[model samples]
Target: MIYKVIQINFFMKGIDRGLNNSVVVLLIIQI
Candidate 1:
């Protein structure tokens, strides 16, 4: 559950930063 929260936090941050879709996907995949 904590890991899931972390992933969501990162996802939100990536969107807030306007990161590329592929980069966000990669980040999620990496996590």
Candidate 2:
């Protein structure tokens, strides 16, 4: 169970990073 939670957290972090990257790209385009 602990391992599963850790895996989920890692997956979520990756998703967050992807979203942040996309937002940065959009902001750069707008500028």
Candidate 3:
């Protein structure tokens, strides 16, 4: 159970990073 939770957290972090990267790209394009 603990391992599953850790895996989910890691997956979430990856998704967050992807979102942040896209946002940064959009901002750069706007500028």
Top candidate, metric TM-score: 1
Instruction: Go through the candidates in order and give each one's C-alpha lDDT.
Output: 0.87, 0.63, 0.64
Worst 10 residues of 1 by lDDT: 22-31
Q: How close is every model to the real structure, measured as TM-score? A: 0.68, 0.54, 0.55
- State the lDDT at 16 in candidate 1: 97
Clashing pairs in 2: none
Candidate 3: residue 7 Cα off by (Å): 0.2
After the best TM-score superposition of candidate 3, give how far the Cα of residue 22 lies from its true spot, in angstroms. Answer: 16
Over 7-30, each residue of candidate 2 has an lDDT whose tens digit, in order, gives 667656767777577755654464
Q: Judged by lDDT, which candidate is best? A: 1
Q: Name the runs in model 3 displaced over 4 angstroms.
A: 19-31
What is the model-wide C-alpha lDDT for candidate 2? 0.63
Better of 1 and 2 by lDDT: 1
- Give the Å error, residue 17, model 2: 0.4
lDDT of 2 at 2: 83
What RMSD does each model have against the real structure?
A: 2.0, 10.8, 10.9
Residues 1-31, model 3: lDDT tens digits = 8876776676567677776777556544644
